[model samples]
Target: MESSLLTCKKKISKKCHVPRIGTSLSHFEPKKRLIVGTKPNIPDLNLELPSDSEEEEKDASDDVPKLLNELEVEIFARVSCFEYWKLQFLNKQFSQLLKSGEIFKVKRERELVKPYVLMLTSGNSRWTMVDKSFKNFRRLPEVPSDICFLYCDKETISAGTQLIVVGKEVESIVVWRYELELHKWTKGPSMITPRVMYGSASHGTDAFFAGGIKFVEKGIPKVCTEAEKYNANTKTWTMICEMHKRRKFCSGCFLRGKIYVIGGRYENGKNLTCGESYDEVKNSWTLIPNMLKDITFKSSQSPPLIAVVNDNLYLLETSSNELRVYDVNENAWKRQGVVPVKANEASGWGVAFKSIGDRLLVIGASPLPRSFIKRMAVYTCRPSPYVEEQVWEETENCYDGVELSNFIHNCCVMFA
Candidate 1:
């Protein structure tokens, strides 16, 4: 196991500080919580870079003799070290700086040179503005029907490009698009396959689906492990890495442009301790280590929340209240914090939580004072972000009728 990256989280006595807009010095405190979403959290959609070398990290520090007859500076909001490229859309200084390639500023010493615009993603769920600082969290509403699988919609752009895509899933899979700027969900292209209890991971516009059951195998309860892919640019489907084992309720995530799959229930048993990673470039699935738990992810009620921070992969073991981080390069596992309020009977059951950004937000149908109110909870929990990530809602899409129950002249037809 790689001990370097797999150590336990170091809790700070107090928060770190990142200076505000006018400050010249560089200081940053990580966010308080990972944003919550409708269903199972999906992949970390944006850039996941290891800390670069000191020399390479400082490569862009030299001041350019302020160019004469200079191009006007384009203003951007506080976009992180990544997603700085969407600046290309702007005609003025935005285009020039994007071409300059000087803003890959990894150094905390150098504060943001360019600004950023945050696109809030939305679905059927509504936003409950918490406060001014977090922008205010958007709360997820109850699904009219039972959930199958949840996916956080994501897109790819040139490294520094900023494009926010959001869509919560429904019982049925339907073509949908989320306008981050508008903070709304609308229909988009339909999927060729309608899969429930399956998870989707992506690189840019390219997305891949893995391990979900199409139907309950009537008398013989069997789960499906079929893996599929979709290309947003092409608007088509292509199958990719088939997991070493078949599983349902499996969770998939994309980190460093690769797919890292973990903790799913299969027909053979509840949890598949083993891990799988598919390299898009290589077009393959190499089994890593199986989870140490003698019993892994058993009876997963929802797709697991999976994310990567500092290249170490982490996930919320749905059935169990604890979180686990698997360091692929190091071949080791480390246990993390417990989900807050997991013990209370009221706090337990019928809960939904997924990782968004650096935080983990949870929503559960809770029994409240006088009446049962569906409450939402947010926590600035876990270690460094393994990667930029978002939560997804479980919904139905392209798949047609799950089963056919009809009558023939002299016979009965039942599809399962």
Candidate 2:
């Protein structure tokens, strides 16, 4: 265990000054509440960073350049996802650049993006929004789902978002759409093939739900090869091709332009080592060349969390609590870095993970002497071969008031 990153959160007194944007230790915890901020909240999607006091401004100017050009702003904007949200407070110029989507445009053109984690944790089954600091949190509507079936985060460059939520309902699987921009929930088309614990991934504009254990008897079930695709725009689902292997409690990731269905267990209490990819152009599924067997260096009770970052596939091995990177071009696996110890300790039940911008965001719990504490860990994923150079920053003691049994159902990262 790394004691350097694990410690109690410091509580601030009344009338304390706000910390600077991008400050690592900016998180503040009060008596029974987690403060989002003492500053004014953003009315719309165009959020402004907290204002700096005069003395703080003087200190910043003395240490760093006062003015930033467009290129400099772009460079700073690409640095941190949570911090990037706070950087909007730097100046009027910085505020305008972010509000006008100029910074995001530069990032998209340069292939740079900052991801914000939208997580679903089980405290009475509620939702909350937090910035990079992870100290401040705002409550949102609960996603109307019982069993986590399929969930995904999608964003539009114009500044809005949606989280597609799906789950099992008695004899069928229900679909619900949560529009982030409107903060409203509406029922969507249900799955043609009702499935639970299925391998799902959203590619392009459609959501795909694949292999899962189909309910036949009261308790005993059978692995399924059936799959379907749901179009968010049309609010309709069209049956798609089946996968090469049947899987349940599996993981799916969209890479390049195809969907890869990774490791999951079947009815025989055995996990599938081989994986496959679906190509819409060919309307078929092709074997992925024993991708899971080649890379699974640890034993995971459930399927590992798989994601695609910068054309490469990354997996979080829950058992070993290590992050591994796989280059699609090289078709080889290598050690990237270890997940934060706090997040690893929380993975005893399961961990929620997603790729935000260039970093990997993980949400898990740290067991304490009396109870458990939920925490979020962020890691920078560099495109370099030197893995040791990467950095991991954690935001612990989040959702402190929530009960520990509120296990994570699902989590996704969205960018506005």
- On TM-score, the leading prediction is 2
TM-score of each: 0.49, 0.62
For model 1, residues 16-97, the per-residue Cα lDDT tens digits are 1223354333322211122233455455669575465422322121212232112122123234323332435534554565
Residue 79 local lDDT, model 2: 63
Off by over 4 Å in 1: 1-73, 76-133, 137-172, 181-184, 215-222, 231-236, 292-300, 317-320, 329-332, 343-375, 382-416
lDDT of 1: 0.42
State the C-alpha lDDT per candidate. 0.42, 0.59
Residue 364 CA displacement from its true place in model 1, Å: 5.5
Best by lDDT: 2
Clashes of each: 42, 2
